[model samples]
Target: MKTDELDYTLPDELIAQEPTPKRSESRLLVLDRDAGTLTEDVFSGVGKYFESGDCLALNDTRVIRARLKAEKLTGGKLEIFLLRELGLGEWEALVRPSSRTKPGSKVVIGESVNATILEPTQAGRRRVVFEDGDVLSILQSNGEIPLPPYIQRKAKESIDTGRYQTVYARAYGAVAAPTAGLHFTKGLLAELKEKGLSTTTLTLHVGYGTFKPIQVDKIDAHVVDPEDFVFTKESASALNEVRKNGNRVISVGTTSTRVLETQYIDGEYRTGAGLTQCYIYPPYSFHGVDTLITNFHLPKSSLLALVYAFGGTELVREAYAYAVENKFRFYSYGDAMLIL
Candidate 1:
């Protein structure tokens, strides 16, 4: 498949700059893949479409405050975006002005927190170690939320610290939030539970690579960076039971979908932790996740390609056109779509 096949026209204004006043207030676009149908409704009412004997799998990976500002030893300003933990006190990061901060360069963040660039790694990333108090605590005091670059706005007040995270977020590792899950509120989740809809949680630490645009002309040529996914034996057993009972496995976000599709084995969901670079594009046969709930992805992204694979290319394109026509929000702080 060609990368341009996933392209769609979206007005600059439709790219949401801020989240909705309420989490569940965002719009939901429902797309019937087989029927080629589209419907618009409030996200809080998503449970209306799913009945009993269905499972909603959610990504519970927590987003850390990963963006750090500091000064280089020579007094140059530096910005480091933490990607993932390499070990205790060590992390993989992307540094701005990478040319200046070569291996062995030192940077000081805040009053006492200092970091040393160990070496350059794959994809222009740097391995850095912090010599300070607990890295997590230091980040809480000095680091800022690593919002997607497309947002182009800073998190306002202190509430953003909480707003940027999903209500069900628990495991800590992700650099980015699973935006589709952002539409869910505790009340809405409880309501679904009351409807006899079972739910399970998995963890995929979304990396900064999620924001990287596809550079290859051919979609198949694009290689994804590996991200860690945690699928416990309990969660797998629950999902397998859902299948055994003749129910649908509804993935809450693309991250969860990737974990499901990648970890799914011979008629059973696999258990334990693993890394996935599973690239789902058009003409791909899905083994798991009968339904998907996802946000409006950016054009020419691997995410959009995955959507094109799940929902037909033309169908997704038409739905996106309708979204643009109806003024549905776009991107991370945007509205959602349910592909069934």
Candidate 2:
């Protein structure tokens, strides 16, 4: 498949700059994969389509304040976007004005947070070690939420801290949120529980690379960045039991879908922690997920490619067209789509 096949025209106004006031109030677009049908509904109605025994897999990774602004000893302004943690005080991050921040250069954030750039890595990433302290606490005081570039507004630190994250976010490592899970609220989860539907969680620390566009014309030639994920023994057993009991396994987002597909080996899910670079596109055979709940994706992105792979290309294109025509919001903080 050609990468161009995934491209679509989206009006600038359609990109959502902020989340809906209430999590469950966002619109839901339901796509019937087998029937090639599309329906519009509210996100709160998500439980209505699932059976009693279905299992919904959700990513519980938390978004950290990865975007930090600092100043060089020489007084040049610098930006550091943390991508992955390497150790207690070390991380791999993207540094702005990379040419100026060389190995051994020091950048200071506020009065106490200081870092030394160690070396350059692939994808313009820099290895940096910070002065030891409670890193999360330091970030809370000195960093800002790394909103997507297309949002087109300055971060409102007080508000985005809560809005950009999901209600169930537990593990703290993700630079980006598993956006599809954003529409779920505590009330909705309890409602699904009452309906006899259960949920299992896995963690995939969403990296900024999730937004990386497919550079190759041939879809097969595109490469994805490896992201950290963990599938515990408990989650593995729950998912396997869902399959054993003949229940559907619905994945909450592409992040969860990637982890599920990556861990599936031979005939079952493998439990443990590992790095995955699995890329899903058209003509791909899905081994774990029966249904997918995801947000609309950017054009020519690997995310859109995976959506086209799960739901047929034409169907997804039509659904996107419908979203545009009806003025449904797009991207992170956008409305959701359920592929069933």
Write model 1 residue lDDT over 55-77, tens digit each, in one string: 99999999998999989887899
Show where candidate 1 strays beyond 4 Å: none
Clash counts per candidate, in order, are 0, 0
lDDT (C-alpha, whole model) for all candidates: 0.91, 0.93
Error of 2 at 111 (Å): 0.8
RMSD per model, one decimal: 1.2, 1.0
Residue pairs with colliding backbones in model 2 are none
Q: List the residue pairs that clash in candidate 1.
A: none
Candidate 2 lDDT for residue 205: 97
